[model samples]
Target: MSPNPWWQDRVVYQIYPRSFCDSDGDGIGDLRGITSKLDHLQALGVGVVWLSPIYRSPNDDNGYDISDYREIMPEFGTMADFDEMLAAMHARGLRLVMDLVVNHSSDEHPWFQAARTSRDHPLHDHYIWREPGPDGAPPTNWEAAFNGSAWEWNEPTGEYYLHMFSRKQPDLNWENPALRQEIWALMRFWLDKGVDGFRMDVINMISKPWRADGSLPDAPVVREGFLQPAFAMVCNGPRLGEFLQEMRREVLDHHDTLTVGEAPLATIAQGIELTHARGGALDMLFQFEHMDLDSVGGHVNGKWALKPLDLRDLKQTMNRWQQALHGQGWNSLYLSNHDQPRPVSRFGDDGRWRVESAKMLATWLHLHQGTPYVYQGEELGMGNVAFDDIHDYRDIETLNHHRVATTERGQDPAEVMASIHAKGRDNARTPMPWSAGPKAGFTTGEPWLRLHPDHDSVNAQRARADPDSVFHHYRRLIELRRQHPIIVHGRFDLVLAEHPLIYAWTRTLGDERWLVACNFSGDTPVFECPAELAGREARLVIGNLRAGAGERVDDLQALVLRPWEAVVLRLLD
Candidate 1:
């Protein structure tokens, strides 16, 4: 057997600190709230807790815009509260992974403040600054991910700075050796404080392409209203590998920690190089290919418009990643995070067969060969919220797109609202439902965002007590990963890759083989054993529903599956 690291066998749970739990009734979650909820996470059987950014910020892009990396946000708590929370998590045998937002810092950060004051400042080269175009327009025809131009003009300085995201965030220049050392020192400080790992946000965009004379030429415009695509030059730049390898040699080599990069437009080949064990770059990367299967116009249209998802395309995308990275690297499996809508609402049936569909998705993702990450509230089958009006939306991305679509594009307000309702980041940002009490047991005061109304019927308190709840189903899946080594190291083979409604695959390790099958739709589908395992005896292992005494068939025959039903069986030779 190949030796595996501690993180390889463990599961990660991501917690958005602002919406997790509120302890002081301040309408926002705090560090003390996270400390009080350690027992809940321990009971859920997750080994790693990946917390979103809790650092001092201006709240422009939630917590992603960091003003101070060393200090905790006053709303979240003080340094003392962070220490207490970290101690509590370690005491419960749970590892903590912090979100590293070094791709860009808030405009209010000390480094940026000093860099923007004058051209001859000591930290002037810390951020990317450029002169206006020949026509006195922005530096380049590049657009930010959150809409608008990528370059923000500084009236006091007479130069523009680059911002791939919002204007409040200024991109850091990794080409500066002193700035790189400063980041290394900050990482060492956190490492000494006992942080187990880091979830690097937009780490791929740190190194940007620049001309020999430091000139940024305009990109080819693709659309009329939209700016040219800048990711081609911003992502996976020339010096990315050098910077990551240098970081590994300086700060990460002596530590036993996990690192995952949030790569937005990375391809499979890029993922392989970034995560290769010998490359010394990162442990794994979160690619956005599978997430865009339902997008109407690909990356340009963003996630606002939706289209029908083709099962064949989905299977091909996932299979390519699994096969390419089989022995060279690792994969991070997930369906939803703070940036996207809920998986149950987007991919599965969230209305009538919510429970079954949730379990089916868990089975389909966990049975693959990789490390699984469970977002908060996903285990309980929590779904998207229904907001009728645009006023109910609070996400900056959603509001910005709504305005651009309605006012700039002359689209109907009702049509924009419908798209926002179907695909909005706020769908995954609602407060976690702890109980049936007011505010869904999230806070004593008004929540930062509204709670889902269905929390009354679907919550932790009720699910924990019921034996047949989605929470328990997830627990069983986690246990299986811990007990079966094959689930972790087995070779993946796609089965029924072209099926329209049913998804199936197999994992094999020497003499042992396991089959995982699921129905994606509400209609009953017929499942047939593949020809390769036609004569093998099938033994029922774990399933969503228990089979009767005579219901277990040993021969390869046709069997009908219920809506969103998932089953796992071992084939004995």
Candidate 2:
């Protein structure tokens, strides 16, 4: 394998189409709206743009439940708009990677629609199906990610079909060779249309737990009255490696495309098998170990049990991936996505030091040893939205959790709202703040989802105009990765690991050693350089504070950082 792939040095920016911009002003973001903003991405210095699903869907999971593989969702625009968007991206030298949601298809999809008709239907095997118990009960105690039983009763067929998510989305049966071919053909269709690659949604869940008797097994109940997450029964199943490798061989191998899968509970060792550079299944994998640091109790209770972000635990988790995947596999560095809360609100201060903490967090993630991903509005420092009323949220996951928690578990409504405020996916689904103008400049009419409450203060116009805004900071970080090979291919070693208020690390590429430090709290923290960088000449690559953006000669041992400050210095011999 070559030392540096093109993807390794470039940054990937994600855009949830519904929240980006509304071109038609019908209250939803569309494909043309994305085409209009190609300049924003080119200006941001991201090489690749990862678009969330714009495929035909019932929107049960906010486009995660795909209904048609060949057509665009009418709310998003037509196929012509998609073609225009892709061409516009390429014209600006930007590559577009579409979200591929093959783990499940909407029940409205033709295949599933036909499959549910009867057991004798030709497409009956297209989706997983099973007979109910003797008394006509659900197949197992497994729970849907959105709530209720994993198996939904199909009256026409007199059987239950598997749906790990919403019942509207039935899990596709990869066990059927014909169904696998159908998926590959759809992938080829997009590739032929000039798409650069795919960001596979929950690709690990394509295969389910199967017993020797050819039946899906039930997961032991962990929470007494509640159904288990069934994570063990759903993710990284036995045939996962075979399926991924086959995918690479059949379709991905033919094109120079970026392939990344959403791996929910994948360990570092397993992550290597799926992404090893030579003879590996994928170019990279988005692992969720680090994302779990601040939470416990998986989706059975909507994972609403919130915990404070522990910097040390984060430090350990990140460094583990860094060391483990250094050469064996690859890593995709991201702090937040459409499925997670806004980074600033979750990890940094969204109240007093929004800008400073936003930059700090970006600096921390981008300087790591992998390709970095930037979620929409992250550069503008948009924090999470705290919708006081549950009616405002459009996310199925958040809505389901709120409903089940308040009614079934008898949890307090206010407490449930607090959890939603902290970890709800709706926080990331809010419309992007393009301007301080009315409607946040996202739409001309009522927005499909609510806009950020502070859009007036935190908009792209405000950020781009300010030299010290988080937007410019992110741009400069991307510039650094492009210009300096060390930032992309360096070895990582964490420093000040025990420091509660500071998260600092060193990166080395041959003789090039750099010190990257971040103050993770609201209080000022003093960070000392590692022994090797104690007296080295300091050249500032980037920093959050305006005064520290250029060359510096401060003593490394007593360097003082302001609240939520971050800096990266190239130590010269």
Candidate 3:
């Protein structure tokens, strides 16, 4: 069998610099801290480490709003530290994927600072700007991703600057040819520094495709304030492909680097086209459809309310993306990230069966035909942290949503606060539970962020000793994927013959075929398969339970799948 694509077969581990580990006893994780944990990550069987932004930032968005593209954040480390970290990672046979936040820069960035100096400044045109209305309000009805108007009033320029996110982050004017070339040069700078690739943050938001009159694309459902005409006008603009191609030629094409874009508003077709490995712009793009399952109403553009995800919709969405992007682009499979809450609390029964359900989720994601990414603390089955008050939140997005859900949306403040508690970045931002000691051994001093109260009980040390813990299960799952080529490069066909709760799929390559059946419900679900479909006897490859190999004594028989149980069986001739 042909070896799979490098990234398709590899697993990535995400590191949030602030919470990873602190070497200086400063209560914040840094480059040295990450280097120290490289062994831990290597032991986890992860081929790559996807780091959150360590670029110089004002920390308004915790490094998302970048102030410098070249330098490391002082709090994280210096140039020397970054160099050493990269070298150390390479030495350990681990690839490093740096976070790229080029769509917008912090207002404090030299370019933006110069632009704000005077309207006649050469850099003044680097960012999108427009005159405000007679009411001294924003230029448009567009909303910021962090809340409030997308346009931020600039007193110096006497114009409102556009920021798709926070006011501190002004969107760059990619329409300028000079700006595009400059950004391309910056990308090469990192590649030259021995970095593997980039995780482009909000890469889709770089373009501005606004018409002269600022009218959005005249579509019937294209309402105001959601996806402005400017968004389409800007995103994937006139020269997006060209710029990406140039970057590929100069930066990515030469090296075995990976580029995964945080494409939020892109459709499945658009995502596939943009990430085609043959000649596409990026290596992969994350689709938010599955992540948005908890969103209420069909209106995908407004303040979201938590809703139960139907098994049918969830299975269908995953199947669609897997099938459509088969040969074109790859997939970046993840259930949790810094922007999301812990998956166990949100999806699994964290209260009763945390480890079993966590393993179930891991099997469900890792066995799929895509590269799996494990966020920090995910392997240990971390759950959501409790936040008694709004002041406990440090994320700009959560704070902004709190305002909209309460004041503008006229919802009860208590309910809004409760939702934030249930679905907040702070949940994921809590310190990693390294041990059972105070502060979970993350820091001797008070941590930059609070540790989860349950850290004492649920920690890495305890999980490491327990063979049946989620951590060990993850290790076994990764080994299974790495050892079997079919798991990575095989054809994925969803088995919808059974109930939606019984999410089963088959992967096959040549004579090698495997069936992965998962029961998502609490009650045991029987998965029925036809004798002809089985082709031959099937032996158990991996199961979340303690069942041994070749226990499959059935073709049209009942299989007892306990709560959140998953099984991967190898078809034997």
lDDT of each: 0.86, 0.88, 0.81
Error of 1 at 514 (Å): 0.4
- Judging by lDDT, tell me the better candidate of 1 and 2: 2
Give the per-residue lDDT of model 1 (tens digit) for 102-174.
9999999999999999999999899999988888789888888887889999877899999988999999999
The collision pairs in model 2 are: none
lDDT tens digits, residue span 67-140, model 3: 88998999898999999999999999899998988889999999999998789999998888888776896766
> Over 4 Å off in model 1, which ranges?
1-3, 223-228, 547-552
Checking candidate 3 for backbone clashes, the offending pairs are 207-234, 207-235, 208-233, 208-234, 209-233, 209-234, 216-229
Q: For every candidate structure, what is the RMSD over all alpha carbons to the true structure, in angstroms?
A: 1.8, 1.5, 2.6
lDDT of 2 by residue, 452-568 (tens): 889899999888898888999999999989999888888999888788888888899998888898999988777766686676677787889747656775688878889999889
Stretches of candidate 2 exceeding 4 Å from the true structure: 297-302, 528-533, 546-550
TM-score of each: 0.97, 0.97, 0.94
